[model samples]
Each structure stands twice: as C-alpha cells, then as structure tokens.
Target: MMTTPIPKTMHAWRKHRGNMEAVWEEIPVPSAPPTGFLVKLIASGVCRSDHNLLTNEKQPSWFQQQFTLGHEGCGTIIEVGDCVPSNCGFKIGDVIALLSVPGCGQDDCPECSRDLPQLCQTGYHSGIGQDGFYAPYATIDVRGAVKVPQGVTPSQAAVATDAVTTAYHAIHRRGEIKENETVFLFGLGGLGFNALQLIRAIGARVIVSDIKQENMDEAKKLGVPEQDLVPVGRSVRKFVEEKGLVGKIDTVADFAGTQETFEDAQYIVRQAGKMLCVGTLNHKNTVHMKIGIRKRLSIIFSYGGQTQDLAKALELIQQGVLNPQVEDGKLYDFPAVLKALEAGNIKGRIALLQG
Candidate 1:
C-alpha cells in the first residue's frame, strides 16, 4: 500500500476537565488500531452539540475527562492496520467519512445485535468526549468508516456523517414518514433543515416552524410554500389554530427540543400521531401525560444514525437529492465557529477544513 510520512504530533482542540472553553494543544499522532485506520483528517463539521460538550457539566459514563471535540469528520486513510480485512476495500489513499459512534458489531452485544449500533454503550464514541478528528490525524475502526462518494466534497462528506445522516435516520427509520403524510417540522437548524429536505424528497407535505426568519426563509427557498411556514415570532400553537391544522398533522418531528416546541407538538399532532424527537436544544423536556394519554401519541426519540444511513445519505447527496448547506473554515476556527453556532448566527452547518 502507498504510505505518507507520519507526523509525531499535531494540534487538536480539546475539552479540558474544568475549563469552560476548548483548548488547542499539540498532541502525539495516534497509530492505527489493529482493526482500524490512521486517518489524516481533511474536514470536520462543527455542531451545536459541540457547545454542549464544552459547557455541560454532566456527561455520559463513557465520556473522557479530556478529549478532542469533533464528531463529524471526513478524511483520507494514511495507514491501514494489519487486521483490516483484505476484502473490506479500504486502502491507505481512500477517502472516508467517520461514524462517531459505531457500536460493537458483536453477537453478544445487545445494541449492535439488535441493529442499533449508534446506541451501543460499549463502543468508542469519537468526538463525543473521546479522542476524535479535531486534530490533523485520528483513528477510526473499520465499522465506522464509510467511503466518500464521487460527487461529494470533503466538507459535504464530513457533515453528512452526522447532520444529514441523523436526519435521514429519524425521518425514514424512526418517523417512518410517508408520501401521504403531512408533517409538522419544528426548527430548521442544521439537522432540521436537512430533515426538511428528506421529508420533501419523500413527497411529504411539511409545515415548518422556526424562531429564526432566515431559517424559515431557507425552508421556503427549498420549495416549502409560504402558507406552510409559521410566521416568525408567532406562537406555534396560535399558528396551528389559525391554520385550522390542530389534529390534522400526521406526525410532529421536533428537531428543536425546546419546552415550547415539545408542548406544541403534543397539541398539534393528530390523535395517535407519531412524534419523532431528534434535537435537544433543551436537555430536559416535559411530556404532559394527560395530553399524551388522551391523544394516544407515539413519542419516539432518535439518536445517531447507523453506517447504512450515512451511506444512503451520501448517495442522496451524490444524486443531488440532498444538498447539505455548509460553509468551510480552517480547523483552528473551531472556538469561534462553535460560538456562532450557539448564538444561532450560523446558517445550516459549518465544516472546518484542514490547513
């Protein structure tokens, strides 16, 4: 296999144990694991969750005290490990997108055996409180790497690993949204905007509600009729009532998990309607049991997407069926980019490129 000179150390943006902000420091480059590859990162996408990682005091059990912070990554393989299967098709020069959390694909593993690898507790979670692709170099297991398609750029491929794939998984797998369904979509941020396109692609009618006028306008430009957009600053409940849409919505997909949006979802969706929860703008949201019981709503929460979802999302992007709105920046711009993301100043998503 072709090889490039491996560097001894590279700069990475990491979340320190007590620091409220991310710290950039030089760290030793990692070697490929027995069943993984050492990757030279080309692009890494900044997510709103990155802000949570920086400031949130509580973390999952597997979260490291200090780790690099970037979950969405795309790169070229620089070193292949000995245990990487010969027939798996990955090579030193191949470009691939990394799955942040690829569950152990073991028969004895509960989550993976049930085909929910994204929820696997035993697996390594790249970037989510784990050493990840914020640096020039990182390592990824074979199961977490998906080859980049011909038409997708490195920026697109990077965001596709999470932003697009998560939306795709929620809409298709969890929501099971159909062409005949009328969906009430909440929020038009990174994942929500991508979810809008995915819903549109499925021939579903989507009525979108977002606090940002720019986000709503972007939705309109994506073929959402003006009538389908909730007026900016208007109460979502009031908008639903005004449109005479109460109990008419087949599914309420809440990609902005704010308290208000969660309540609005319960009020608007039809009886027995499905509620697909994908975002967590507010970590804890209340579900009114009386309303839920009376309406018989099905509340479904979705997390990260599987490798197949990423592959399918890439295919859609390649086919021009899904255009992930993203801006490019240098890897060092992570702090500023994340701040802008938290302030809701960024439109869609931002991908940081390696300098």
Candidate 2:
C-alpha cells in the first residue's frame, strides 16, 4: 500500500488562453471526487489527439480556462472516494490505466446501454472533453480506471491506456480485418505503429504508409518490408497501377486523417473494401459519392475504445505483443514537453513523467 501523504497542492498544465497552448499552474489538489478516486499520476502520453484538442479553435463550451490537459495516463490511487466500493475492485495504491473518454457506468446512458461506455456522453472525458491527467495528481471515476496488471511499468501502462487501446479498436473492433487479407495502413506515427503490430498479430499482411520517413524507418525495424511502405504524398491511383495490387487491398486504415490522407487512401482500397478512420484531426468528410456507390466501399470512423478494448489491449501488453517504440529522452517537465509537442518536433508518441 502507498504510505506517502497526499500533497495539498500540485503543478498542472492548464489551458490559459483558449488556444493551442497550456501553461504550468499551481492547482489545488482534488479530493472527495464522487464515484472516483484521486490518483497520483506516474506518467501520461503527449498524443497528436492532445495536439488536435489544443489546436481546435472551438473549445468545448463547458471547458474551463485553467483546466488540466491530458487524456492518456497511468497512476496510483492515493485516495479512494466512498462511492468506489470495495467490490468495485479499486483501492488506494492500486496502479490503473486512465480511460481517455468519460462514462458514468449507469445503465441508462446510450453508450452504456450498448456496452460502449467509453463514449459516455454525460461524464468526464479525461483530458479531451474534461479535466485530464496533465497534473501530478488528478481525479478519475472508478469505472474509468482499468487495472494495470502486475509487471507493467507506468510509462508502458500510460501509452497502453490510449495508444494501444485506440489502435486495438481501429484494427480488431472496427476494421474486423480477416486473416491473410491485405491491409493498407496510413500514418505509421504514434498510433499507426501500434496498429501495425496488432494487424500483424491477427495474421493480416500490411501495406504501410506515412508522411514521415523516420516513421517508415521505424516500421521497417518493426518488420514492415521496405517495398510495402507507401509514401502518403504519392497518388494512390498511380501506386495501384504500378504496384499491380489494384482491387487487392482489402482495407485502408487511415491513422492520418488529413484531406490528403483521406483522398489518397480512398483510391487505394479495393472495391467493397473497408476504410477505417481513427484520426482526430483534419477530418474532411469529402467522400467520393459516385465512385463509392459503385464500389460498395464501407467507411467506418472509430473514436476511443470501449472498456473491453482496454482489456484486450492489456492482455496483449501482458503477453509482450504490443510495446510501441518511445522516442528517446523522456521529458519530466510538462511545459518543455508541451512546447516540443506544439512544434510537432517530437518524432513519435511520447511519454510525460512526473517531475
């Protein structure tokens, strides 16, 4: 059990000016969070999705000017509120993964009715639609916490909470790709690389693409063949004709959701092929209607994963099948990490550790 006394105040990265920025601020330590527990965060991920939330001109109408920023987190519970019963399975000092989305775990909510509480419309969306774990200490609903099995480090658990879970949702839950089918993966950066491994684990052949050469090189090191890596800037139609895989690519998973990425991938997917979209930025709904109608192409968009998806991701993590490469030199200071993230200077998915 944790023996350390809780601090009365902690440092946090708060969104100050309603723009693509957050500044470090001294905040009151949270306590007595209803149905949730106060946690001491070990680490959190600085994701492109976090960047997407920061860049959007329109902040959620209810967002506080000084709210904490972060969705991917791994923490140890320091104080469990009364609402979190012993049978709820969480307690003080237990390590847990934070669910990026909010959920009340109530039976009547639409997302809960469907057993998809990650899309919980009525509760905290930790770090995205609500106060997240950018702070050293934060509060989270007990239902939103996923137990980190023994042997997972805080950094790895932090990444797994969102990156691996989201990728699992994209590949296994949403894409439903079959064995031996050819899958085209766009954007092998942060989340794409994780999706690449999950797809391989399912026995599907993967064709990788990315806007960054560094990421392609990383995927190559992960066993993606040099020839199978398509440059996203190239015309998809031309690549299809040249590669002679026209109508053979079964699915196109777009982790890069720019207009260019979507438009280019639209042409690469086979007739009746599925295009699974998981990116949070640059979402252009410019579908090619006539062509899509004729081809019977299926397009699916997935947000964060459900609780079951987290379980599946954790299972993979336990089996040592899903460790995405972390960029060198972990950042302990939140402000410096935010600066690097805003510049898009960080090469891959990054972890932010407590100072």
For each candidate in turn, the TM-score is 0.94, 0.90
- Per-residue lDDT of candidate 2, residues 1-355 (tens digit): 3387778898787666455666667888889587888888888888766666666747666555556788888898888887667799777778988887757667888877776777666767778756788888888887778898877777777888788888998899889988989998888767888899999889898988777787877888888887787774776668777888888999999888888768866787889999999874584558899878888999998877866788788878778888765542243465576678668777666778876
Model 1, range 1-355, lDDT digits (tens) per residue? Answer: 5456888999999999889999999889999999999999999999888888889969889888889999999999988888999899898799999999988889999899999999889888999978988999999999999999998999999999998999999999999999999999998878898999999999999999999888887888899999999998898888888999887899999999999899889888999999999878898988999989999999999988999999999999999999999999889989999888878787778899997
Model 2: runs farther than 4 Å from truth?
Answer: 17-21, 51-57, 231-234, 327-332
Q: Give the Å error, residue 36, model 2.
A: 2.0
lDDT (C-alpha, whole model) for all candidates:
0.92, 0.78
Candidate 1: minimum summed lDDT over ten consecutive residues — where?
Answer: 1-10
Top TM-score: which candidate number?
1
What's the C-alpha lDDT at position 220 in model 1?
Answer: 85
The worst-scoring run of ten residues by lDDT in candidate 2 lies at: 326-335
List where candidate 1 sits over 4 angstroms from the true fold: 1-3, 241-246
